[model samples]
Every structure is written in C-alpha cells, then in structure tokens.
Target: MSATPAPNASQSDAFAQLLRGSLLPTAVVGLGCVVVGLFSSPKAAWSAAVGAVIVLFFFSLTLLVMKRTADLAPTTTMMVVMATYTVKVLVLGVAMFALRDVSWASGYAIGVSITVCAVVWLFFEMRAYKRLRIFAYDPDGAASLETPAPKHDAAPTDREPRDEP
Candidate 1:
C-alpha cells in the first residue's frame, strides 16, 4: 500500500493550523520572557531562554509526531506516544541534573518562563482546535485528512428525494 504524506506546518490542515497557533504565541511569550528576564539579570535571561526553548521544542515535537502517526493503528500510536513521553522525561531529568550547578542560570526564571510559554501555547492551540470544523463522528463516514472536505454547494445528489413518493 502507498503511504500518505505526513502532515506538516506548511499544510492548511487542522493540525497545521493548531501548530501555527501554538508556535506563534509560545514564541511571542518566550521572547517577552527573555526580555523581562534580561531586565532581571543575565542568569535569569539565560534561564528564561532555555526554558522557552525547551517548551517550544517539546510541544512542537509532540504535535508533529502525533501528525506523523495519524494514520497508524491506535495501539501503535499509543506506544509511540508513550515512548516519546518517556524519552522526554528522561532527557529533561538529565539536563536539569547536569545544569543544577550552573552559575549563570536561575531556576526561578526558567520555571516562570516555561510555565508562561506552555500556558500560552496550550491556550492558543485549544482556541484553534475549537475553531476548526473537524467532526469526530460523522454518521455518513469519516473525512479524509489528505483531501479537502466536499463542498455542500458542489451539486445535487440522488438522495435529495422523490417529490411524489
């Protein structure tokens, strides 16, 4: 069987829109945090930048991975997601442990920036998802992700009805 193309940020697909919405706000807030952190101290600035980058990378990777796995079996998707989560947690733990004694990074700045950026990203993503017309359960059938949805005004079908019947 031929494989479908993986979803990307370049597409006008639902996940792509959500990805854009999430990334934009996270980036803006991340920058703001960095600027504010700079005003506080160099250490704080570095911490804030690191935190923002962490949040952006993790969230984007999750979304993109999910998009890539959209066509996979549910069990396979779950396994992939679990593996991803485990790896992320382990990486984060190791990084934090390695950086615990860094003289130029403030934990407070990092924590605050991570929280703010994650919140902003999640909020915008939720908003974008809410605005999409994706139907989870259609009585007719499920819609295809690789193709545009059928337009209502395209043409009349036999199902219209018999006037005398």
Candidate 2:
C-alpha cells in the first residue's frame, strides 16, 4: 500500500505550536504537585512525578498519532484518532490499577496530580485550537465550478443529434 503524504510544514508547525502551548502549563502544575508532595512524603512526591510522566506520555502519543495521520483521508484520520484514544485510556486505566497498591506510591497524590495536569493540558490545548487561523475552505485554493471539463477523443459528442421516441 502507498504511504500517506507527509503533512505540510504549516500542519507540522501547528502541532508543534499546540505541544508548546500545552507543555508549560502542564509542567507548572506537575512541578507544583511535586512541591506539595515533597512536604507530605517521599512516596507522595514520587507518585506526583509518576502522574506527570503518565500525562506527558499520553499527550506525546496523541501528538504522534495526529502528526502521522495529518495527511491521511478524513475517515482514516478519524479512525486513527479513535483507536489511539481507546488504547491510551485502557493503558492508563491498567497502569493506575496496577499502581494503586504499590508501597512507594501515594494514590491520593497521584490522582490529584494527574487530574490537575490533565486539566491544565486540556485548557491549553483548547486555547491553542481556538487561536489557530487555519480555514476549512480556502476560496483561493478552490477550483472554479464554471471551468469546462476536458474533452477526451473517445468520448461521445454531447452535440450529436439523438432520435426522440
């Protein structure tokens, strides 16, 4: 099968910009969680860090999928997006369950950190999307509907007289 064409520079740049926008807020929240956890316990601190890492991991995975699918057909892209989200959610759930009773991890701290970081990332992403200037339809790029289709040598002439019953 032929590979999908690579995304244009602008499309790539938009994804990069989205990542950049989300990164700072998420990092700040993660750092704050770490600081708060530090005062609570070492386990808490570690859990907070793990939560941050998890959020970042999922975010990166999403970005990677989006980049790879950027040039694909819309239906294919949507399928990719849905599949990725489903996998990400399942993995996250499994990880959380497995780590729930771990001795060195504070469940409360991890939960809080994950929640905060996820929220921060989502808001940043939403804002970035809102600020993006890309248009769904570009008038300048559209072909004129009035343009005549090219005639092929083998095609039957439209002007040929036809007998009407």
TM-score of each prediction:
0.68, 0.77
Question: Model 1 residue 10 lDDT?
Answer: 35
lDDT, candidate 1, 1-165, per-residue tens: 997775543333877888988998899999999999989898888898998999889888877787788678899989898888777667655655666567778877877887788789879989988888666776465454447766898776779666994
Specify the highest-TM-score model's number: 2
Alpha carbon lDDT at 29, candidate 2: 89
What TM-score does structure 1 among the candidates reach? 0.68
User: Lowest summed lDDT over 10 consecutive residues: which window, candidate 1?
Assistant: 3-12
| Candidate 2 lDDT by residue in tens digits, 93-138 | 7777777788889888888888788889989988987788777777
Q: What alpha-carbon RMSD in Å does predicted model 2 have with respect to the real structure?
A: 8.4
- Enumerate residue pairs that collide in model 2: none
What is the C-alpha local distance difference test score of candidate 1?
Answer: 0.80
